[model samples]
Target chain A: MKLSNLLSEKRPAILERWFDVVLETYPADTKNFLQKQNNQFANPVGHTIHQGMESILNGLLSGSDLQEFSTPLDNIIRIRAVQDIAASQAVAFILSLKKLIREELEKSQRMDSFIKELSLLEDKIDTLVLMSFDIYMQCREKIYDLKANETKRLTYRLLQRANLVCEVEEPGPQQND
Target chain B: MAKFSAKPKDLAKIRYTPPKTEWTETPVEFREHMFCHSAKPKDLETVGFPYGRAWSAKDDDWKLPDNWEQIILQGMKDLLGKYRSFQLFMDICVRCGACADKCHFFIGSGDPKNMPVLRAELLRSVYRGNFTLAGKILRKLAGARDLTVGVLKEWWYYFYQCTECRRCSVFCPYGIDTAEITMMGRELMNMIGLQLGWIGGPVAACYMKGNHLGLEPHTIKSSIEFFLDDIETLTGIKIEPSFNRKGAEILFVTPSGDLFANPGTYTAMGYLMLFHELGLDYTWSTYASEGGNFGFFTSNEMAKRLNSKIYAEAKRLGVKWILGGECGHMWRVLSQYMDTWNGPADFMEVPKSPITGTVFDNAKSMKMVHIAEFTADLIKHNKLKLDKSRNDHLNVTFHDSCNTSRGMGLLEEPRYIINNVCNHFHEMPENTIREKTFCCGSGTGLNASENMELRMRGGFPRANAVKYVHERYGVNLLANVCAIDRATLSASMDYWVPGVGVAGVHELVGNALIMKGEKERTQDMRLEPLPEKEGSENV
Candidate 1:
């Protein structure tokens, strides 16, 4: 099936804006990291994050049949596992995806924009999968309601420091070794 | 699928009945009392921009009811009527049940009502019947019931039942956080004066005085002095974290709680030691020394007022650079709001550690440093002395906090510190750890004994993973850089995962160090050949 109708035709601008937010929020250390390693988005962490997203997005794009980065849904829920590196919150991260959807749909035509929008929105929702798993590991601790100022600063600092993380989820379960 | 169940004889263990008695009742109505309402609509136009003036507890005396029962009922109503986001989110849920299986607590406790979406319905249903157009028009025809007094009391009960972990948002198609529900719940409960004294007392203290611990100036400086001596004793270093030193190169600020507490204090020591090693010109601000940002748990004013102290103090000191401590929410406040409070601190200088000349341009003035980022840069540049052999037995694994790890995406720097220092660093199960990791069961100050069951259940998933690694890999040590995770997880690890120990990321690094006075402590690479490790177990 076509991807445009899924997103209902607002995917291109969403994609650019989304990438812009994610890229801008990329942590200071990340650019530093790229320079130091002399590899752009090709580090160990980068590969894992890209692979995780590739599986989730590609799966939805191909009508849930994409098996390239396949891992059963229960074992390793598809999401941005490496994003936990730089501190983030519910707003900015989700916003990044929303931005991505708008960008993708904006660039599409009437014939396929709808499906593309839906597909991208589906890909964007992958953040929830990432978040649920993220909160699951941390559920070991007490989670508090973030005070308002905290909500703001934490999001900003996280945005500033976004580039530092290796957003790659290497497509293997925790090795039994 | 495993039947999710938790009869947590949590800290102040409550007597448990059989499954029939506990699980039979549908206690969904209790969702209302724990949440508050908005005075305005969400700013969907500019999604990130807050829609209305922020909610403040300072002015919470807004016409509460008389006669205690009616007062609570009235307060609960006012709460639902208060925040626009709470109201908007409640009105908007499509009940897709997308978040049904995402709750770790619901899974751990085996409570069906614990499902995040259903748990939300406990409050949302009331809002619908009372305020929403559809519910009011067809209350009798649909499942939408009126907000009765009974519902108000129930709202108080179950809303407090949630730990505000935000797990459900991950599955939410619209990305709604159930933690927001919990926060609204808490805000409403406070309005009615039905409070968990533990968090309430600290909130009041922090708003009035700056930190949760409400540490006084002399005591704070003295505490830093004491940690300095402790470092001197353990690592044979006599470096003092200079306080109020005029015109220092960098201003060091941390949650004063760390200055007094164990693992936090140790983390503070790690920062100071690294500064000393680098011979950096950093001074501690007695005023802005509080990096905790208690304002985070309450209203924007409290958060802003608390955060403003740091910038003002920075201005007072005339320092060109500022650094934050290893606290989770503290980093959140520092990273986002500082620029808003005093835009573009023109006097502020980009941090330059003379010890490690790794230039951080983005981190110049408008940036804050996660201690691990700073330390990772040091290690990456080979500035600090090395000893990989001493950390062999550590078998360290990282406990990534939701705030620092996921909120900020600071995964690599901490791991860089851990992998560089510890020999056998193991990763926990993929989805159950990292940016999407679980909370330490007490991150938002849900550490009261009354919340013990929540802590135990919330913390069970993490304990299970630690148990997995410890039993499987002989990984006796859990090394995390976040102070709260170390403190809370250490408590849980000792209680649940016996024979396993937890340490700060720096403690491990410090242990494996070629200290300035290594001969005095212990010459060998072992973490501590001396008896120093015996009692130095705070962080």
Candidate 2:
């Protein structure tokens, strides 16, 4: 059987393991709360991680295009980007999935073909990590943008009040003299 | 095992679980983005706060006065005696954990200390250790700890984390207002000159200049004049709003945020349009320009001092009653604390609507009416012609600003106003609205740029609810009745759920209000084109 088919069969277990790996990055109290809370609105960070991980697992197992993983990666990374974590740790969850998949697959019958397919799957995980990095940067950039925009928004009318900002006139049709 | 390796097993060994020490024993590591900068000495001096010195949260030494611990303990002792609620809150918490999960900060960041119960325990433990005999005899066993610099740092870190939105107090069976505890906590900290710059700066500004932004009298006029320009462009009716004019029937006071900020400025325009349409006799006061009191975040006396401006301005202007604009904590202070602090507003009448003759008997003591209550009364009386379809572009969801909802019991007025103004309005999830509403998470001077990460975490639950409505109902706009909500929720929306904009409740009213003999408006107050006019030549 192909590694993808094997991954598809073990999707639920792999997703859970991946989520556990991600949750481990948080403090002990946070991990406990994230694991215990089931309400999505009440535990949004946990919900976002769970939902994002599920979508990411599906995208990986289905051999979807790497670009298709943007939304799921964004769902998770957007949170981590603003969380009190290092940038490396923010995207480290993507790499942890490679180990999680490997550990999950090790329980199955390991044929010669599995090794070759495993390397290819690992390569895709690597690419996903790269994509997660881009998503992380985008989320960070968006935060900075929001910060700058807040100041601008706060001072916008004040600037106009100060005669510092003015509306430019729209270009009128040239008169044929 | 090697920390970094090409092999997956070796790499996966780098787990990031926290240390296994108990919470009280664990020292706080003041990381960047987790805390705000300390208050500058100048701001402290401006308010005559004692022990004012240059300090940073990142520093090893906070440069405290030698008797800082004594000051805190004495301050706590005075507060315990002065405020019965403070002492009761200190003693009466059963730790039922009803409030543990209610904090938006806890739900978002998963910090155990962010839990309202635990956050309060940080102070209660000290009270136990120092104030009670049981705490002195059996310290650790009684859950009491000595007031070390470490504990003080912990207090500063956790207290500021609280927005004082009081979602926790709602769930507490004993009705322990943790917000007051936080206020007490902040008040004690201010005794040591440990106020946050965001809170202190604004408190000082509001103290000196009558507004948080410190816009001078002429600047306030010009700022409103800028809004007048937009209102004229939109409705083609030039609104000449009075400033500091005596003998006006209503003295209008709003958060200076409305006069300075984006969506808030739009809301300011709404108030102008609404007042102009009704031809109400209202005057904006430069002296009482700020409705939202940052002084409330500092100390009770400071809050009282700042709040005195409104009644003073109203008296000076000789207004019949005060009509407050759409703001969150301002209404909380107005409805809850204003009369107690600066009351017997006997000079002003019982806020009877000049247009509809509807008496707001609820505000008879305070003699101030919320714009929502005023607008709801207007709509109920059918006093104003509203073209609700004008707001068709916005699939609106009302975010009950924490202060307005939980603090002031102003649950219905904003909703009534929204239903009357907009074509499409959807309520967020039941738990996330009304009395149980989550904060914008940037309240009580926590809305600083340095603490964006903290704000984002604190805002996650609110934004999560907004995301639900945004995805399900295609809700594009978050309508709130708070200026802070208008400012902070915009950042939260942009971060968590992009494409959904935040607006003041009055901004929607400005959009839907049809003025007499006004030219056809192609745009809303934000100068964005109206729904029907979108992509049309009229835009």
Candidate 3:
């Protein structure tokens, strides 16, 4: 059987295992809460991760283009980007899927027949890892930008109070020289 | 540069299981970006806080007073005796986990310790270990743990993680206010001079300078002058608001953040424009310049000390009653604690709206009225002309400031005004607003930049709700009454749901208010061109 058909067949199992791997990044107590409580507003981080993983899994199963994965990738990576984890660990969930897929394929005893397809699937995940890195960096950069802008916003009036900032004059039509 | 050497197999070897040890046995790791900086010794000394020595959360030696354990235990004992709510909360929790998923931090971070129940347990465990006889006998089986340095570290880490927004209390079957428990935890920490710089610095500044920004009297005046300049440029009307003037009809106090921060600065301009248009006889007091009391985050005594100025300033200025600006905790303090803390404002009369001639009998004792209530009355009486289309550019949604909604129940007034002013308005999910509002996640002085990650995590639920509205209704403006919401939610919206802006409700009101004798307006209070004039050169 083809790896794609096999993946489609094992989509639920793969997605569950992938989610467990992501949840493993949190503490045991947090992991349980994230897994059990499913309300979107009440458990947003968990809900976002679960939903994002499902979308990415659906995208992967259908062989969708990389661009189709941005929203899902962004939803999950944006969360991990601010979580208490290292950058490597933040994007590491994307790569862990490769090992899970390989194990599942090997368990099905189809590794030899689908080696080329497996290689292509792993390549797609590698591209996803890079995409996640970009999203992670974008979130982090936005945080830094927010921090700097907040300081500027907080001090904008203080600077004005000190006469350090002034409104720029709108340029008028120049008189003939 | 460090090379990316780990292979997929190696990375996959990362453990998926938590350690087998019990949660109580697990020590907290104070990771980078997880906590705020320690209070400076000078800031503590400024407010006469005990054990005013330099300390850092990262350092092994906290330089704590030698008898720190005794101080904390005794402080806990004293608090239990003094506040019935604290003691009742300590003893009453069944830990049904009703509040487990309610805290925004818990929802966002998924840290069990961030759960309101467990966060309270961090203290309740110590209460069991030290105070109860059955706990001493039963010990580990009774969920009791002594207040060791490790536990103290856990307490500091987890308690600071809570914004004390009280969403948990709404869900608790026994009405256990986790916020008061956190307040007690903070008070106990404060006894040993363990305080966050973001909070402690403001406490000292508010105590000394009458505002958290440490702006002197002249600087406060000069700040308002800048807002006046902006107001003039927007409306072609110069407003000359008085300060420290005797015999004014009312005294206005607002969070000093409005005087110094963006979005908040615009809110202050909104107040200036509104007051000017109403021709209100109000005087701003440099003595009681700030309505926000950062001291409330510290201890009951400090909160009273910081709050005493408003009534005192009102009396000194000989005003009839005090008018508070849009602030979260300020109203919480004013409506709940201020009357008991510093009342018999027998000297001041009950607040009556000058334009509408409406009596604020609810504020008879405190002699203070929220600006939302004041403005709602004005709108009810048709006292001010409004052009709702002036705010047509904004698809507005109101974020009920946690303190204002849960703390004082000042709910309908802001909405009534928003519905009157903005043409387009949407509500977030029913669960995320009103008395059950999620915090801006940076309230109670947790809005520091070093902990931006933590704030964003805590603010995720709020931003998530805003994102829902943004996607569904194209909500570009989040209108709120709290000054902290204005400042902190700005960063949160930028991080979580970019393109949605945070503004005070009155800022919307300022945009929509058609002030008498003003020139044809071309822009909103933030000086952005009005939607109709966006492409016109006349602007």
DockQ of each: 0.01, 0.49, 0.54
The i-RMS of every model, in angstroms, reads 18.9, 4.7, 3.6
Per-prediction share of native contacts kept = 0.00, 0.62, 0.62
- Per model, state how many residue pairs clash: 123, 0, 0
Q: Cα-based RMSD of the predictions, in order?
A: 19.0, 3.2, 2.9
Model 3 clashes, total count: 0
TM-score of 1: 0.63
lDDT for each residue of candidate 3 in B1-539, tens digit (9 for 90 to 100): 01245788887675544466777988887876678998888999998888877788888888878899999999999999998999899899998989998889988876778889999999999999999987899998898998899999998998899888999999999999999999999999999988999998998988888989888999899889988898999999999999999999999999999998998988889899999999999999888988998898889999999999888888888999989999998899889998899988999898899999999999989999999999999999888888888888889999999999999888899999999988789999989999899998898878899888889989999999999999999999999999999989989998899999999988988988888889988888889888783232100
CA shift of B492, model 1, Å:
1.3
Ranking by TM-score: 3, 2, 1
lDDT of 2 by residue, A1-177 (tens): 788898888888888888998888777867878988898887889999999889888988887898788888888888887766667778888888888877776677564558888888789989988988888878767767878999998887777766788899998999998
Return whichever of 1 and 3 wins on DockQ.
3
| Winning model by lDDT | 3
C-alpha lDDT (0 to 100) for residue B101 of candidate 2: 86
Alpha carbon deviation, residue B185, candidate 3 (Å): 1.0
TM-score of 2: 0.95
Regions more than 4 Å wrong, model 2: A175-177, B1-14, B533-539
Using DockQ, give the best candidate's number: 3
Question: Candidate 1, after superposition: displacement of residue B45 in Å?
Answer: 37
